[model samples]
Target: MEHRALGRSGLWVSEVVYGNWLTHGETVDRATATACVRAALDAGITTFDTADVYALGAAEQVLGEALRGVRRDSVELATKVCLPTGDGPNDRGLSRKHVLESCHASLRRLGTDHIDLYQAHRFDPRTPLEETLVAFDDLVRAGKVRYVGVSEWTAAQIAEALALADEWGLARRIVSNQPQYNMLWRVIEPEVLPLCRREGIGQIVFQPLAQGVLTGKYQPGAAPPVGSRGAGFGRAPRFIGRVLGDAVLDRVQRLRPLADEAGVTMAQLAIAWTLATDGVSAAIIGATRPEQVTENAAAAGVRLTPDLLTEIDRTLGDLVDTDPTKTADMFAVKAEWARA
Candidate 1:
């Protein structure tokens, strides 16, 4: 696997980060989860990302078990906070109480003393930004979290946090931001990508394949494959509906020719495209089977030529969504905290 610096930080991670978003605890059994993790490691994937809220933290527990014999320092393990792990009001968000408690719990669940990177799963509007930063700073100082990041944070939200971290002389600035990025979803491009590039924040993009739509597995005007993720087996079927439409699927079908010309599968072509994006540090892929891990990992070092990339752009020109308005406010406090 190819390795890259994680957004101007000293840390380096595999270009293809193995993530367990919808597979680990909920969709697959323990044996399959362990086999996939082992396959990822065998494929030289050094970064693994999960969240405390995934399968109610069972994902983390399963991931931890999978990595039991592997050397801890050899891989970069990351998890997130600010998601409700329980019903209590204090069980969620970036509040100090929740942040500290969540980190401790994550460490225990992951069977690691320190998380290589701990991220804010979403912007916590109810909590002060300074409070959140300070809590993460404390974790860093206390040797619990090595670096801090945010997921699905708007460009404006990241800027505010960066400025505050500078002002407070915190232990670490946000090193990364995780967002849903793919050929079809360019919401992060117009603003988030450029700002993050300048601020030295690397984007660890999730859903790089548009949740497998880019794989060309879903045919236009046909029912989704019986056992596919789009067939209602995975989590968050609501968002998949956007990409499963006939219009989008037909456009995606056009990319198969390009994939064939490149001597790669449609999935590899799509993954290679994301890795080629300027500000991306890693493209997270969630796999259910071991062979799937190996197949996607092939894109780690595959480079697309300028002509191929241009052809891809032209084929999917109108289909792309770069309007920038599609960027969602996960915290629901855009009016109060967003910059003008």
Candidate 2:
């Protein structure tokens, strides 16, 4: 597993970070989660990313249990806060009270004293950015967090946070953003990627396979696999436009030959595609099984030729959104090289 610096923060994470999303408390058993984690560690995946709200906090507890007996120094643990982990008014948002409280809950669940990277899972409009940044700074100063970051933030929101942090002379700085990026969806290109590149902030994208769509396991017009997330994650409810509409399946089908030629699965190809770009610190891939971890890790060595990359992009066809006004544009970021 190759390591990359996570933005301006001195911390380094594996190029392929492990994530626990739908799998932690739903599809995977404790033994299975441990096996998957062990496989990732064996393959040198040093970073494990999870959110405080996943499975209503079961994911964090399970992850902590899974890491038992493993040397802590060998792995990097990254987790997020701020997603209504509780119903109380103080339970959510980046307000200083909520931020500090959430940090403690995550810390207790993960069984770790300090989180390697702590992120605001989404923008909290109610909380002042000044309050959030200062609270995060306090965590770093108090040795509760090593780095601070934001997720699913627009470029403007990210800029505002940076400006506020700079003004405050805070102890921590925003070093990374976690967004969803894949061959089928590239909204971050125009919205957030450019700002990251300009500020030297690293990016670790979530859902790099479009919530299993880019894996090419689900053919057009076919039912989702039994016991799979798509069939079971009805409550999670993926956006219809991104997941079901616009012939995403057809485009995914066209990539089969390319993945085969590279001696990898479509999932591997999609993950590698994200990493091939500069400023992507890591591609966080979640798995329900150990084999999926191995399959994704295999992508580390598969490099797409420039011609192949261009061909793939052209075939994928305008999946990377350029307009900032569209809701989908939040997902499709403008590529730094994209002609405005």
Candidate 3:
């Protein structure tokens, strides 16, 4: 797999990062999860992403076990905080107590001395931004976290945090932002991308396939395939329902011919399209089976010509969501939940 520098930092990550979100410790069993991780390593993927909120921290345990035998220095492990890991008030958000305790808990679960990248899962409206940054800076100073980042944060939120970090002379600034980006979801392009580009914060994008919609497996006018995420096989992600509409599915079908012309699967075409975008350091792909990992990993270095990209845009015209405000809207929803 080809590697790229994560923003302006010296850290390098594989173009295709294997992530376990809904699969590990949720849908797929531990043995299958380990197999998928092995497939990722076999494909030369050195970066793995997980979160404390996924399956209420079971995902990290599964991922930690999967990478147990691999050389510690040979891989970059990333996880997130700021999500509720329990029902207690202190169990969530980016408060200093939560952030510091979460870091130690994540370290114990991942079986690592320090995290390669520790991210704020979401912006905490309930906590002071400086308190959050100070906690992250403390983790860096204490040698628990190497780099700090945020997920699905608005450009304004990021700018405010960066300004505070600079003003306070924190040990580390944000290095990356993890957002859900795909051919269908272009919300980050207009605002977040340009801001991060200028700020040197690379994007570690998730759901590059639009929660499997871009894979063209869901039919336009039919029930979702059995056992698929849309079929709700096992605790499906809530976000997948938004993209399962017939309008989106019909437009997604139009991209199949383009994938055919490129001599790649629908999934590969979708993933390759994300990598082609500037300011993207890596695209995270989750897999239940090892062969799926192998198939998606092949998209890491595949180049899409300008003509093909234009054709894709033309085919999916008007079906894409490009509103920059969607990021803030999502943040607001999460913030309300935090208040509750």
Candidate 4:
């Protein structure tokens, strides 16, 4: 797998990161999850992404077991905080307490000494930004977290964190930002992309296939395939359901010919497209089966010509969502959760 520098930091990550967000401990059993991780390692994927919130931390344990014998220094491990892990008021968010405690829990679950990338899953408006950055800085200084990042944070929020880190002379700066980016979901392009580009923060994007919609497996006007995310086989049908409309599925189907012309599967084409974007360090792919991991990993270095990219845009005309405000809207939802 091709490796790229994560933003301006010295850390490098695989172009295709194997992530177990919905599969491990939720949809797939332990044996199947181990097989998937094996497939990723065989396919040259050394970067593994998970979160403490996934399956309420079962995912991390599964991932840890999956990589038990593998050389720890050979792979990059990334996880996130700022999500509810328990019922207590201190069970979530990016407060200093939660952040510090979550890192330790993640370490024990992952069976690792230090996290390669520890990210804020979402911006916590209720917590002071200084507290969050300082907590991350503490982790870095204490040899628990190597680098700090944020997920689904708006450009302004990222800027604030960077500014605080600079002003406070923290030990580490934000090195990456994880967001949902794909051919259909271009919300991060208008502001987040440019800001990260200028600020030296690489984007480790998730859902590069638009929650499997870009795979062209879901046919228009037809029921979702059995065992698909939209069929409620994994976590819930909520995320994939948003893009299962006939309009979106039909347009997605139109891109199959482009994939055929490129001599790659629809999934590979979808993943490669995300890597083609500027400032993207890696694209995270989740899989239920080992074969899916092998297939998607092959898209690592697939180069799409300018004409092919233009053809893709022409095929999916007007189906893409590029609203910059959508980032803020996501943050607003998280803020509401904090209030409640």
Give each model's whole-structure lDDT. Answer: 0.89, 0.81, 0.90, 0.91
lDDT, residue 306, model 4: 93
Candidate 4: tens digits of C-alpha lDDT, residues 1-340: 8999999999999999999988899989999999999999999999999999999999999999999999999999999999899999999999999999999999999999999999999999889999999899999999999999999999999999999889989999999999988898788899999999999999999989878989999998899998888897544576677677787887888899999999999999999999999899999999989999999999999999999999999987766677888874432222221232
Cα lDDT tens digits, model 1, 1-340, are 9999999999999999999987889998999999999999999999999999999999999999999989999999999998899999999999999999999999999999999999999998999999999999999999999999999989999999999999989999999999888887778899999999999999999988888889999997798887778886555565566567777777789999999999999999999999999989999999878998999998899999899999999988776776566566322212211221
Q: C-alpha displacement of 275 in model 4, angstroms?
A: 0.5
TM-score of 4: 0.96
The digit string of per-residue lDDT tens for model 3 on 89-160 reads: 999999999998988888999999999999999999999998899999989999989999899999999999
For candidate 3, what is the lDDT? 0.90
Q: How many residue pairs clash in model 4?
A: 0
Residue 274 of candidate 3: its Cα lDDT?
92
Better of 2 and 4 by lDDT: 4
Instruction: Give TM per candidate.
Output: 0.95, 0.92, 0.95, 0.96
Ranking by lDDT: 4, 3, 1, 2
